[model samples]
Target: MENGIIYNSNLHFEHQRWKGELAFWKDELKFFNNRLSELVTRWTNKDVLAQLEHYQNEFVLHNEVIEEMLEDIEEHETRIAGQSKTGADALDTQMVKKHLEFRNRLETQRHIYSELKKEFFRFLEKYM
Candidate 1:
């Protein structure tokens, strides 16, 4: 799966990048939940609404990133299919191979994010 670009190094980088992103979002989600809980405890904290709105916006941005990644993967797959029918040359073959590897990595990351998202919401729902 390394495509030979320093094989294990690239694979390790991909794994680290994926896990780092997952860790970031997981932390942000937890921070929002905790802040919301703290705000709920105070009687006169009326500005916490803005913080929640910020969290919502951040969530949307992250969601968009995921959606765009999915769309890109789909686009690559379609391109690969079309290129094959057209007797793709060397460059096209290389592009398709790269796309397939990327899609595989992104899909794996997506699955990890999904499970983390579910856990985040489940915990927040308990407080809500």
Candidate 2:
């Protein structure tokens, strides 16, 4: 039926969107993890203890966002399974809201990460 075809198309589009989001989150997390590792290797001074602690805390916060992104992907997968059209629509709306929130958090985390990296480099230049 035409209705079935339309529903299938919508479902396919939704899946594609979800896949894009998954890829984006995975890439962001990988970048965050790599940066954290690099920072750890570069931090060699015991005197910069305050900055080190701040970096560690920010790293943990970024990690929590990554975890939340993974959880959101898992929930989306579960919701898509055998879902009705109405349910899927509702889930899509919820997903959009969640995506917006995640994006805002990601932007904030990125800004913090950049600031931390700049400070770390400045500390190195000043002390080392």
Candidate 3:
């Protein structure tokens, strides 16, 4: 049997939620970047400096990814709004597929961010 359809309203809510999560992550990355700056100024150990630089680069990359994701989410939300104006009760199969893809990407990013966060804390505890 074919999978059932999803409501546009539901997708809209989900997109909003995803945007909120991304915003929170962006703020967290900013905070981490700030902390890394402080750590960099205080430490001169070669190994620690290397690790700190790595984190600094990672945070910048993560922030860029978050910005891209936010843009994608905004576009998706716009498409959903357009679809809703047509009085459609269910999203198209293609839209549903895109939704799943977006969700998967978000999950993967979250996992990577979580691991990086843990590793960063461990580094802090070990060096600081």
Candidate 4:
């Protein structure tokens, strides 16, 4: 939701969900930044490389899934905006279906993030 946007007829549940996800990602980035920095500072060369590999694999999977979902979200929002102005076509219907599918994947990714966060904390507790 935009800063000044009100809960009017134009409001969408999808929009609210996306807004919450965006905020979550922002917080996740900051947490990752600080934790990664602290990890790098304390680990030895070989341990650092191994740790980097671990995080790299985890981050790559998360990033790819998140990016794909975000792309679908953007495409869906564009379709909705365009159709509202000029009416929906067959492609618009397809976009709506794709959007629903992507939203499910987005929710799955959120669960994945929570699991990865737990793994991260466990790693810190055992190793650091």
Candidate 5:
């Protein structure tokens, strides 16, 4: 999202950068799940564990869907490249549609991740 990860004493800068990426929906879904795992490890509340588990399960499903969409996109692209002018045009339209659908689903997953992160942090604040 930020193009690269940095580590230094510029805490506020780092946070601002991360927040900027989140605001732009540029952060990857996989990274969000990784951060969730890190948060879960620091959590001591058993009640929140179930909710985290649910999020984890949802992430697995999202990952599967993302993978399938990527495969479909690649397949369509290949077909378009190998087809005639007329056929290629049709595949091109279909590819764009699939790309948009995939992006919409990805955005939904990102929103879910954001909500989960907020909830987990709130739980930590309340219980930890």
Candidate 6:
């Protein structure tokens, strides 16, 4: 953001970067799900199976959150594009605020997801 104004080019780049990160997370989640499936199949202990089920539910919920965030990002990008006065115009204060809010939400999601990933890996090490 330059002088509280976000240029169109900058916004586009930021949006693309965030979208790419989200896509990678989605793919990683799928891989994690596959691993969980394998563990669930091999494990027979009731306690271990229950923990696997818990992780499955968490991953599913995180997937939904990722999808929702992607949709919201698309809508925000569309809105920004629609409001652009010129190809290289800058966003207004309100748009800047909105973009910052999105950035914060994205960071929060990333942090939470990272923690979840670490927890899952620890479980795998202990049980798998």
TM-score of each: 0.42, 0.46, 0.92, 0.70, 0.49, 0.92
Q: Write one digit per residue (lDDT tens) for candidate 3, span 1-128.
A: 13565888788889889999999998898888888888888999998899999999999899999999999988888888898888986888998899899999999999999999999999888876
What C-alpha lDDT do the candidate models reach, one value each? 0.56, 0.57, 0.88, 0.65, 0.55, 0.88
Between candidates 1 and 2, name the one with more favorable lDDT.
Answer: 2
- The TM-score that candidate 1 achieves is 0.42
Model 2 C-alpha lDDT per residue in residues 15-116, reported as the tens digit of each score: 566556556655755665565566567767675655656656765675666566657655655655546545543334555465457557656755765686
lDDT of 4: 0.65
* Predicted model with the maximum TM-score: 3
Question: What is candidate 5's lDDT per residue for 15-128, written digit by digit as tens?
Answer: 344345444443355665776677688777776777667767766765665556455545644554565444432333454455457557657766876786686568556644
The 10-residue segment of model 2 with minimum total lDDT is 1-10
Residue 102's lDDT in candidate 1: 74
The residue ranges of model 6 lying beyond 4 angstroms of the native Cα positions read 85-88
Which of the predicted structures, 5 or 6, would earn the higher TM-score when compared with the native?
Answer: 6
Q: Residue 51, candidate 6: how far off, in angstroms?
A: 0.7
**Can you list the residue pairs that collide in candidate 6?**
none
**Which regions of candidate 4 fall more than 4 Å away from where they truly are?**
1-11, 45-49, 87-93
Cα error of candidate 6 at position 10, Å: 0.8
30: Cα error in model 2, Å: 10
TM-score of 5: 0.49
Write the residue-wise lDDT of candidate 6 on 1-128 in tens digits: 67666687798899899999999999999999999989977999999999999999999999999999899888878877787755648877787788889899999999999999999999989987
| Residue 43 accuracy (lDDT) in model 2 | 64
Residue pairs clashing, model 2: none
lDDT of predicted model 5: 0.55
- Please give the range of 10 consecutive residues that has the lowest summed lDDT in model 6: 79-88
lDDT (tens digit, per residue) of candidate 4 on 15-86: 567856856775675677567768777777897659756875786677666666667666666666676666
